[model samples]
Target: MSAAPFGFFGKIIEIDLTGGDARVLPLDTALVADYLGGRGLATRLFYDAVDPQCDPLGPDNVVVIAASPLIGTTAPTSARGHMVFKSPLTGVIGTSNSGGGWGHTFKSAGYDALVIKGKADSPVWIDIAPGKIEVLPAHHLWGQDIHATNDELTSGFEAGSRPRALCIGPGGENLVLYAVVGNDKNRVYGRCGGGAVWGSKNLKAIRVQGKEKIQIHDKERYQSGYDQALYLLRQAPVTKRLMRELGTAGLVELINVINMLPHRNFQDCTHRPEDLERMSGETIAKTILEKAAGCYLCPIGCQRHTRIDGDDGSTQRGEGPEYETVVLMGPDCGIYDLAAITTANYRCNELGIDTISFGGTVACAMELGERGLLGAEKEGGLDLRFGAAAELEKLAVDTAHRRGAGALLAEGSYRLAERCGRADLSMTVKKLELPAYDPRASFTQALGYMTSPSGACHLRGGYAVSLAFFGGTKEIPRFSLLQSPIAIRNMQNTGILQDSLGVCRFTGYAFGSDPWSRMLTGVTGMDFSVFRLEEIENRVASLERLFNVEAGATAADDALPPRFAETPIVVAGEEKMVSEQAQERMRRDYYSVRGWDSEGRPTRALLEDLAIAPRAGRAS
Candidate 1:
């Protein structure tokens, strides 16, 4: 306890904007033992800082930025950072993660996490450098997009030792609920309104730069674990070839082949072969791709660098329209033009908005327009029809700047549906829009979305589509109502472990429990095993559930949207829905496994067994 943990710098900082003060605090070793790092420790800190009574957009809401233990080292794909906050979008306990270079630098600055609170009197940004911390005026940077902000911040800074700025765009400045906090001008903590939270605090950005070597406790053991992880990454076909070579967009046609690709706002789950081909990763690579980009310590390099000719004869370049962004923005909106999707993706990153939410909500408006319910000439002169590339591009900007119908569209899909009196048309759970995968086509995927803390989130819900579409490591039935819950739980645990460790989720594809355990034990000098890691993952999830329950969650919140219950995907003339009976069974099975009541709240005994107790801020 006296010396720093092998993988940590043994420092945590809390900043209060209202008072313009900051403090470094000590984290308990036992607490660190229970909830390793990344999202786990951040979740615990969130509960300690904010309760159900806290207003999400107000100063009372807590913003926790934490790093995983494996960061700042030779660990593969280890540069990850997590943010846990009260979601201004979903009105629940929320979290988002990013990996570029921020975490490693932050750790090098000798801190494990940063908790931000209160609000600045004016626009400001925090500077974190080795042995230095200060809040500086950002009045001029207030209205700029993330790209411009990045350029301005790094303008005169030393290129060799430049600080990495994580900032928001005009979307956040306008309080667009789904605004993103972007890192390195492209990589973002994209979901659950992380940018809006920053905007609320009058915080424009955070810049981190540092120089420190991360010490390895056991060199031989760490090398052995590191080598195993590297070997797995090289050997895994999906990670090395499919993701590294083709990028995530390669899965577009693969999902289409399985009849699980969401098209036209979930009205159809598959597209015509030609359209699917046009929107696939191969098409992007052939047309406008410049290169593949990788995060810190990552081997796969799944990020695609694309550039397409702009309307004025210039070229627009951006990082990625990952599979989720491509499918949600392309097929979901019925726009198969890859260039158009690329432009929309570019606009999203530039403006700091969640492309999934923005595209999905716009697609909902498209369906509403088709039904004559909305989007008329009187409705802000908006063309909410499907497949209008120009309109789509315009709307992306409008949403970020809160222009025209973009103002309404910024409310996100669930609230937009409520305003239009058509929540049934919205493909969402817990008010957050669904990702690219249609749950009706994949039962396990459906369960994950329904029960996810962030509401219909695919990644937070464990991306069960790996087993459902691509053959994953575990062999589980994609459609069996009986067996999918087990796999979903396993996937969720794996996600928790990865998130907690601050490594890329793709690591799960390459290495399983053994590699992860070896990495943690070797780097941190902790006794790690598959069994111990699962326990920690479960404890983390249980604590999150406890946070939500205290935040007024119920079993009803664990259910899907009304559309998923009634409307079924007619794929190849086979009507398929997750079904009321199957969904009920999955919920029951998952609850039984979690030792929770039917309402998804962890029982007292379960918390006791996990050594988790409700904190002082937990709501009565």
Candidate 2:
């Protein structure tokens, strides 16, 4: 805790809009090492500064943008950034990960993180330069759409020197619970009501332009480690194909093989699986691609820049819908048009909306229609039936604008369903909608969704690697219901290790590779054995779970949607049911692995083992 600079830029910026004050604070390495930066660091700060029960869509909310140690360094796939805030949707800790140059740029801007609190008297924008910070009035920018705001900011600034900007649009200004902060026009720190936080703050944009360079502990070793990672990724089929072929969208076809392509919500996953093959990135390249795109320091180039011929003869050009957005907004909502799906994808990012939540909301409305709850009388007289592309597009626009019933839909799928008395129709974890992964088919993902920190999210620990990609399915290990619990608990611990390290979960496809650990060693010059790294990951995951428990989350919140647990999913003419008996066994196993009681809460002994000993202090 000395004043000497170390691995970090050795600084964090705290901004207070209510009092219009700003200050730089020294970095605490203890916090960095324990919390591990990015999501973990932001969560630690949140726990220390804000009350657990604070309303997420209020001026008192704290939003922190954090970067990891590997960011802006010679690490592969280090383009990830995080936006953390108390969630308006879940009323608990929420953080969203995004891929772009924002994180690195923010670090370069002379700070490792920005903790924003309070509200401006009027709409305003934050401008950060090499050595200047300004809070300018944004009256003219108010009510402008996301694209327009990006356009104005880019044009208003000097050419070829526009700072990276993260801003909320009308959706956020309206405090929509699913609102997000759109970055680079098409990329977003999407999910967990970030836009609503922006709205509550009377803030329009955060513009960062830093000329400072990141200092690594050992440049030679870092470069060597990075070269090894780059070499391995280039030779690896999964990484290369994902970059060259379809990007992450390539998983669309792979997951479909195991009946994991969610179609029409969790009610049914059965679909024309072959149709996925025709829509690969290779196919998109031939059909409608304009070019490929990537973020800063990223050689993988997994982002696709595409142009599709719209029905009106105009064309839509931007980052095409990735796998999760494509499925969640396309097949999950029962819409199938590729061009339409891409357009909707662009619209979601442009409107500062979370596609997963928005699509889940629309799907719930569609299901409600089947039950005679939503129709002309409700839903602003829009017939929210499944597979209606034009209607779906209209709904997307409406929700973005918060027009008519779109206002309610913009509250997210969970809240929308609750309003209609069909909450069970909405497949969600906490208040977040289920992502593209269907756990009924992949038991690993099922357990992940049920136990994730930020609702039903797959990225927490995408078990598809072990389950469908690698040896996870070799024998389909027939575990008696008695053994299923122990197996799932083991997987959860392994997954926690990866997330805590802030590495791409794809590295799990080659687990023994230890890509993240090697990068950590290279960057920090701290030799860490694989076993020690796994222990750190386990402890980090356990810490996050404890944070949730202290905030009142319980085993009751750990259960899946009634539909997912009670109903049978008939996929490809095969009936697959996630029985309650099976789920109970798995939950028990997960609890045991973390050394918790039958309930999912962390055990006192387990916390001590993780070195997060109980003390008279806040959860952080």
Q: What C-alpha lDDT do the candidate models reach, one value each?
A: 0.84, 0.72
Q: Model 2, range 13-99, lDDT digits (tens) per residue? A: 888999888888777776666666677667666666666667777777888877777776757667567767888888767777776
Model 2, which residues run further than 4 Å from truth? 155-162, 273-282, 375-379, 465-513, 527-529, 571-574, 613-620
Evaluate candidate 2 by giving its C-alpha RMSD to the native, one decimal: 2.9
TM values, all candidates: 0.97, 0.92
Predicted candidate 1 versus true structure: per-residue lDDT over 184-293, tens digit per residue: 87999999898998999999999888877656777788788888888889998977877767889988888887788887888877578998888788887787779987
Supply the global lDDT for candidate 2: 0.72
**Which pairs in model 1 have colliding backbones?**
none
Q: Who wins the TM-score comparison?
A: 1
Please list all clashing residue pairs in model 2, or write none if there are none: none
What is the Cα-based lDDT of residue 396 in candidate 2? 75
